[model samples]
Target: MNTPKENTYTCLIVEDEPISQEILEVYIQDCPQLLLKGVCNDAIEANTILLNQKIDLLFLDINMPKLNGIEWLKSLDEVPEVIFTTAYPEYAVEGFDLNALDYLLKPFSFNRFLKAVNKFTGLQKNLAISDLSSDLTITVKSNKKTYLMKTSELNFIESDGDYLKLYRDEDCIVIHETLKAFQSKLPQNNFLRVHRSFIINLKKIDYLEGNQVCIANQMIPVAVSYREGLKELL
Candidate 1:
């Protein structure tokens, strides 16, 4: 028999309809790996919870009173992984465009809900897998000189339009690389791209003063989109 799964994730339901909320609650309750944290009739209540607590998944509805789900998503500085629940199919493209885990139509079956949960879990597994690299030394070709550097010796990475600034404790290298492509080669657990233009080694955090991450003597700006992911580390 398979081992019993632990309830490691906290989930929130953001549906206003009574029947829909009850159904979604039942579906969530049956899952061994999910813990229902709260239910919000509107985005305001949900936003309060998000600020005070950490949510792993958000079951969000498109149509709601006062504040709609899409609008709520836009207003959030840091958002949990979301699965959009809607009666209308027209908003599917927009939901997926915002990187929602799944879009569930009205009267969705328990199996369908479970599939969306599985998709979220699968993504978590992939991120964990990427952190399995045991390589110590990092080799990068910059111009005519091939640089061989130890992974632990690096401090942070900064994007300079078409080039990247690889910062070490003693020296920094300006290489012809984009932050996105160069970030892929970095160890996931040790380094994170906290902003569009900056990636920092998690171990090097001096302090977190508001939205700024202090590494060494430099203060790095943490973009709203990437702040939640960094919170998991802090």
Candidate 2:
């Protein structure tokens, strides 16, 4: 049995769509570990909320009328963990460039939302633990079987249609999970989102070419928009 921790994380939602905002709000209400700070329609309004409050997490939408999510995050010198939500798949790489904790597509289901929240919970637990260097493990369920994954074993992850493919040294496992969910479980230090559809383990990267990253024998393409930040990571 798992007991809810006493620490409550405050989250702010910066979404223009009313329906999406409501859905996210409901999910926040269902989670005992999260508290809704506020919801804003655009980056301008979100900046106001940030100025007047203490936020632990930000649920931001990529496209907006003015000061898009990516641009707004880039302007911020001090930012909380960000989870980007968008309808366009192309923005995925740009979202990672901002160092978002996760990227959620619009019209996401409750189960998928739960997975992202679970990742947030796991991260919180790891932060609370005194031992930071301990070998961390997480479980991903595929075909109704739970697979234990060590952080060090992960090389990179790629998006496959609606599913996500997890890559290890020589093994590749496809799971019916979103990249957003797994992103939350990973530590920010070792894992970096180098492309729209890919997240690479920084430690596993051997070298980087013009728009590709070499990890073991795999050469992953790095989106042009994300190349600058990916270069900084390398």
Candidate 3:
């Protein structure tokens, strides 16, 4: 099973709307590494929280009274990793210009939010590999039951919307996890993410037909961009 991350990031939310603030608060709570410091209705309130607490990350909104997010962000001397959560797409360029970690357009689904947080957590994992490194067993939960499977087992993984289908020798396990998140947990040397939506074990490949890989009567397509790197690995 993958090791749990213990380096929690203290997060502060600066948003004007009550509904948006509540939504962001819940999302932050869902991530085990994120501890919500406080939620502010405006930049003025958030400044107080920043002064009183050491915030590792900030979920700042674009539109607010008196001072906007961009203006407030520009004012800071030393800023934390900021993820802009806003209803406007026009502010995305300005947000990234300030070196924002990510820009989340309003009305984003939970899966979308999870994907963004995954990027943040992935960076943390790289910074502290000794603490975050996993065992070869991958744990997946389906219908409230968790299953642990070894990474070395014969298999390939396919994306299925907000989930993935893990095909082993004789059994296929369906788990509620995106392919991207699942790909990050696997051993990089043993598993290859051949496409955006699929990852396969290199040892299980029977043969390559054109851009497709035949493994245990299954055909997995390899994207043009990944084929050259895959050939080099083989």
Candidate 4:
């Protein structure tokens, strides 16, 4: 049997919510690729640690008490790859502006967490290979079968309860994953979650209604909560 490679990435968590922080720590422990370097309740504490220790990644919260995650990231002379974890989807654009690896909304599942980690790993690999292009392909396993999907071919993805429906030009594929999981796999520059259940490819958008996004002949509803953030992406 081939053993899983022991890849270790030092990570720092800067989240105020105790339960969320605990959940992240547990997930880090479970991931063979991750190593917990430190945890802090706010950016100030995280800054102190950053000055002393070398951190490979950061799991930061957008709504910190004093200095928000975006503010903190801007303040830093050198910033590591970051994955923002927050309850507010309104900060999605700001998170992307900071070049976050992925943005995890609150109440995320283990499967979703894994997806973010996978994206981070992919990013690191691409960086090592000096491939800075956001356009790429991803392999997804569904129904015990692996499918290679080009990111550019994706039009939009919709959540059907627990599963995600990925729509290409004329084809659609149902994958056993959440919208959050699919969001992690996509490049932030090209994809935007216009609703809790809908992630639309910016390049594929034919037009946008008040609360609806049109891709080809299909129209996807955009939730009121996500409209402001979606506008930023547009």
How much lDDT does each candidate structure score? 0.88, 0.85, 0.84, 0.87
Off by over 4 Å in 3: 1-5, 129-234
Q: What count of clashes does model 3 give?
A: 0
Better candidate number, 3 or 4, judged by lDDT: 4
Cα displacement (angstroms), candidate 1, residue 189, comes to: 9.5
- Compared with the true structure, what per-residue lDDT tens digits does model 3 show for residues 1-234? 133346877788899989888888788768888888788888989888787778888889989998998999898877988889999999999899998889999988788888888788777678677334433777888878898888877479999898888999978988888787888888787688888888999878999999999988999999999999889889
Top-down lDDT ranking: 1, 4, 2, 3
RMSD of each: 10.0, 15.6, 15.1, 15.4
Q: Score residue 100 of candidate 1 by CA lDDT.
A: 99
lDDT of 4 by residue, 1-234 (tens): 122344667889999999999999999889878888888999999999999987889999999898988998999999999999999999999889878989999989999999999999887786755434457799977778899988888998889998888888877888898788778888887888887788888888889877788898899998888888878877
**Relative to the unseen true structure, what is the C-alpha lDDT of residue 187 in candidate 4, on a scale of 0 to 100?**
84
RMSD of 1: 10.0
Candidate 1 vs candidate 4: the lDDT winner is 1
Off by over 4 Å in 1: 1-7, 132-153, 156-234
RMSD of 2: 15.6
Which candidate has the top score in lDDT?
1
- Sliding window of 10 residues with minimal summed lDDT for model 3: 127-136
Q: By the lDDT metric, which is better: model 2 or model 4?
A: 4
C-alpha displacement of 108 in model 3, angstroms?
0.9
For candidate 1, lDDT tens digit of each residue in 1-234? 132345467889999999999999999879878888899999999999999888889999999999989989988999899999999999999999999999999989999999999998888777666655523677787878999987677788999989988888898988998888887887777888889899998988899999999888999999999999999987
* Cand. 3 Cα-lDDT: 0.84
